[model samples]
Target chain A: MGHYWQEISALTMRWVRRLSREKFSMLFTLVQPMLFWLIFFGNLFQRAADTQVMQAPNYISFLAAGVVVMTVLNNGLAGGVDLLFDKENGFLERLMSTPIHRTSVILSRFIFVMAITSMQVLVILGVAYLFGVQPATGILGVAMILLIGMMFGVGLTAISMAMAFSVKSHGDFFSVLGFLSLPMIFLSSALVPLTAMPGWMSVLAQFNPMTWAIDAVRPLILSGWTEALPHVGMVVLVMIVFDALCLYGGAKAFRRAMG
Target chain B: MDRTIAIDVSHLSKTYDSYRAVDDLSFQVYAGEIFGLLGPNGAGKSTTLRTLITLLHPTSGTATVMGHDTVRDADKVRTLIGYVPQERAIDRFLTGREHLQLLGALYHLTKEEAAKRIAELLKLVELEAHADRPAKTYSGGMKRKLDIACGLLPDPKVLFLDEPTLGLDVQSRLRIWEYVRMLKARGMTIVMTTNYLDEADQLCDRLAIIDGGKIKTLGSPVELKIALGGDIVSLTLKETGRISSLESDLTGRPAIKTVRATPKGLDIRVESPEKALPAILESANRLGCNIEFIQYNRPRLDDVFIAHTGRAITESIPESETV
Candidate 1:
């Protein structure tokens, strides 16, 4: 466990170094999703107030849960790209050649990416707060939302890393980003309520881990976690399943890649 | 067992499909020695190094670094060895100090140890002035220097430098050579690979002439040159089409040991270039082939490459093997 912590700290240091240089570019990745939240959530909730879909006074508060989840998910999925890039650049080769444990390299990325997601959620939430979006609950609710988001991020990142090794994508950064981001955002409850969707879509939302994460934190952020245990439990269950599947995929892909 | 051997490999082999990249290749690099792998492209120089660094597992064989097994004990071996790859591995986003410190932490150094080592490495690579600058802003030489510093972070026992001066200017290349020598002076064991004949000649204490996944010969560079018999007097046929045919005309000459035509010209390595040049000139005119130029110089590592692999080192790599 101490070794694991060492790897995590080292990995976080590398990310900070990398992000620190592309200082302005990182803002683009962090801010672009929030902009979507503002433009889509602010206008959509205003239109939905007359409809039966939005029961809350300000739908943007309900929307904050989704924004937090999506931000964490996208960041986590792309966090896998860090490992992919290292593989491409021969950094992984350099590391592998050293005395460092193979598992440490993979674990470090997982820990660091989760940390980064935590920070990113804070930044996004701060922005949302400025737009008059506030969680009705205290610090614990916010921490629960971020923790659940981190869990989802880990699962998504594992899968992306698996894909990165199995198939080499030639598309540039934004192309890959656009290819992955929109489908995931639409499929989950990030944009609309699960009940607002058709019966089939609600079933899909139940299976979508993003939907579980949003539903887990939405009531907690708007009403409080005392009322959101069921959603939180569901999210936790989905995360465990997804984490296992993704870790399996990542490990298999890693064997094939390292060979 | 006493750390006398910096590297030891027994029956090391790696194969890709029917093509064998390294075929039961084996050799040893002793402590505080600058050992060289001398070969042309496709001679499996990189493959051998990759295996030692635990980047690739040997298909069959045992490789140990500083008495640590490269395969079964890869994690421990990884911490003990510093590998400088053929290509650059610096992260452009990080400054020199940050990059070294990050990698230092990965090696599990304490905070104070990491800081001290980062400062020491930056100074060792002569990048102390540029330590705080982002690597993206560094010049090619500066980047390479910083990269070498990053490799030295853990105070590794055995350092693997694969083609260190590959694409740099002459001055920077020499600078790298000087640094490697300095490391050796400090009692660091180093293994280096190079296709350049002169680099190996100037630096390697002992070298293995690798070709076609096999070690054709291994010895000190001077001894290898002497074993290669003195000088190479190469004949360039005026007509390129007849280059291959010239070999048949000059096959049984007493002065010439071997004759072959490469992309460069007709290369002939022989025992006595003084006698072979006169006979070669007489034979070329007799065969109705005009000689463009005939130059005789002492046998270089390039001739050793040709003698071993029958291939030139500088020929562009095929598209599939570009990386």
Candidate 2:
């Protein structure tokens, strides 16, 4: 329990794999995004080609990158709501009585949720690959992008968990998720690029963490890492800062939850 | 607080602005005893348990388990104790075997060790027949057994059970009681908290009767009953309204120290009901109160509780404390 990274990783792995075995939520996490990629983006892209002033590239690839970020954000955003069920069942109290490492308990959950989301991203990419699209970067870039994306995902996860600890039941967490998730996704570059949105929306996107992640990964996926350094550095910096801050907030919130 | 005891709690109080959930509570659970903390709902039993278990920080005091401070050495405490929380905690999606194995692995058991422990716990809770089925498919009793199995996965030295058989069927409750007895025989120290009075009466070695965040009394059941002073007389009244007026009239009578209206009839607490019966009958004949049924029985825990708290054991209900 003292140095819990390995144990946390193992636990996280188990939880993530367990998600695949679960039905309702797992379906939402894995398949729902795929449908969004196909239907919503497909409809919008059909009309984008007719705009004579600007070129809309292969809309599917454009949408796939968004799906990756969306998956991470969605996964991160949903992490703590599950704890509500744990509270209801009394498992949270049971775990607290154990001699397990506290850090492992917190970090392992984030690692696991993000890990499952990463698998979902892979599935999206796999299907995207079948449609004649390729990641502009190779395995290394994809892995690094994922790593960064995951770290940011952890930050968002911390925020959600912090919120969950303050709420009494799962019902409250579900409603709060809407208030947190939609704004972050919309304000970020999930559905469209910053330039494509209205002026005020672009300005709002500038401050959005999801927008930062989307900008960081889109170039890496669309044109590979060789195309930008400053952009990548900015996203990485934002992710790390938020990751540290949110974790601290989460730990504080978790400690308070016991009261 | 000395940091050497297996479980030490001191002046622990928690307040929610105005609610005052737990107030200056203190207790110690040593190495090996099936200690029961008995109380009614919202008597802060689970809050006290949670604070000792290191799930919550005390607003004022401190608790240490296994010679490690709950606040400073929570991870160590987590490694040392197995807790069966009050609410039934189980993932319906996971199989019994898988859930046990997953929990075992979390405790850093080698795959072999995890499997072995899982196997033992499954059989111990009598879930060996359905080890491979998902917990969702389980009956409430089966799920409850599996929940207990999950707690046993780590083989903890001190087991903390918070209402282990709550909401279980009679048969399942019997089986779980048997399992709990077996656990105690293995020399494990268990600290059990229950709002249900009977569970404590049946399962505990020694009980602490808690009310309104304070220990009202602590002793073996027999000792507590004996200390309550005398045998009880219960009587059913032909009519309840006839007794109250005559109760005060009988109190100063030869054999009567006090008179109480019981569900059975008008009961007279006395030194000798048999010797004083004719005098009581003469007095009652003057007052004209008829009795339906009557019996003399030994005092029970509920009576003891009433004597001390001046309230019925079953009343004054508060919400189930969500730990």
TM-score of chain A of each: 0.89, 0.88
Which window of 10 residues has the lowest lDDT sum in candidate 1 chain A?
A48-57
In terms of DockQ, the best-performing candidate is 1
DockQ of 1: 0.56
Q: Lowest summed-lDDT stretch of 10 residues in model 1 chain B?
A: B314-323
Cα lDDT tens digits for candidate 1, A90-171: 7778766655556777777777778878887888778878877777677877888787887888888787777666656525
Residue-level lDDT for B231 in candidate 2: 54
Second chain of candidate 1: TM-score?
0.77
Q: What is the lDDT of residue A11 in candidate 2?
A: 62
C-alpha TM-scores of all predictions: 0.82, 0.82
DockQ for candidate 2, C-alpha atoms: 0.51
* Candidate 1 TM-score over all chains jointly: 0.82
Give the poorly placed runs of model 2, Cα more than 4 Å off: A1-6, A23-28, A38-40, A49-56, A137-141, A223-226, B1-8, B28-32, B64-68, B233-294, B317-323
Question: Of the candidates shown, which would achieve the greatest lDDT relative to the real structure?
Answer: 1
- Report the C-alpha displacement of residue B292, candidate 2, in angstroms: 12
Candidate 2 on B109-150: residue-level lDDT in tens?
788888888878877887899999877899988887887888
Residue pairs in collision within model 1: A98-B78, A98-B79, A99-B78, A99-B79
